[model samples]
Target: MKKSQDDAKSLQERALRLLARREYSYAELMQRLSRFASKDVVEEVLDHLSEAGYQSDQRFAEVWIRNRLQQYQGEQRIRYELRQKGIARERVDQEILAANPNWPELAAALYRRKYGEMLAPSREEQAKRMRSLLNAGFSYDQVREALKHLDSEAEFD
Candidate 1:
């Protein structure tokens, strides 16, 4: 019995170590830890980590949103991903807008990255670019605002 308890403790510690290296949402932690610990043990360790302030979904969401947006120009795609990661919807929204994302800027940057330039020389090209932006998870308004004399050469960072 004592050996079993010690093993559980060890697993928990290893889980925390992995988490400390980088942020992990609750669901992410479970997915990663399940390999080393039983479902019940994983849950127990998660609960302990939560109570001890070592794990916080709110913080995870906030950091994830900030990092992804800055690194990837993530918009709705990242928002949905965070929800899937078990972050509360409200918290995800709060974190996403915490830095007040420049929607037009992000859209322009993403558009430029996916397409060569905002103003296509031909209507067909413009339409194709528009479709690409939409598929990249940008809203119509965002695409319009971004493409309205948008320049990708301007660095967002």
Candidate 2:
């Protein structure tokens, strides 16, 4: 019917407006569009947009990874976030592998930016630093390497 056609058109318009603002994963767009229309309508509109190359999970994943890296987030955090956004595990792994960031160096850089040079940090201070790095999604090995490298630098200074 005309009403259904209008609904699809409006949904497509809304989707384009959103895409104009930023890249959205298909899952994200679905969540957003579902609020306004039925699941079938939203899916159809999204499928059309996807076919038109206006929506892409792969592009969304790539852009998301790049932005997170600029914020100095680690691979684990990026992977978790991408998954939360409905990106598949294989896609997440592939994008992360494509990124190929240096984990230890990134951790060390983040640490240096945050805590600075600590000539004689106490055990408590060390623990705090380790916790911060871990929470930032750095692996144990990466966190240890970061602290060890910084501690040695501080000792020499």
Q: Identify the candidate with maximal lDDT.
A: 2
Supply the global lDDT for candidate 1.
Answer: 0.78
1-157 in candidate 2: lDDT tens per residue?
Answer: 8998899999999999999999999999999999888999999999999999999999999999999877778878989999999999999999989988888888988887887776235888778878888888889998888778887887788
Candidate 2 has an lDDT of: 0.89
lDDT on C-alpha atoms for all candidate structures? 0.78, 0.89
The residue-by-residue lDDT of candidate 1 on 51-104, one tens digit each, is 988999988987887777665444777788898898888888788778688877
- What TM-score does model 2 achieve against the real structure? 0.93
**What CA RMSD would you report for each candidate?**
4.0, 1.5
Q: What TM-score, computed on C-alpha atoms, does each candidate reach?
A: 0.81, 0.93
The per-candidate count of clashes, in order, stands at 0, 0
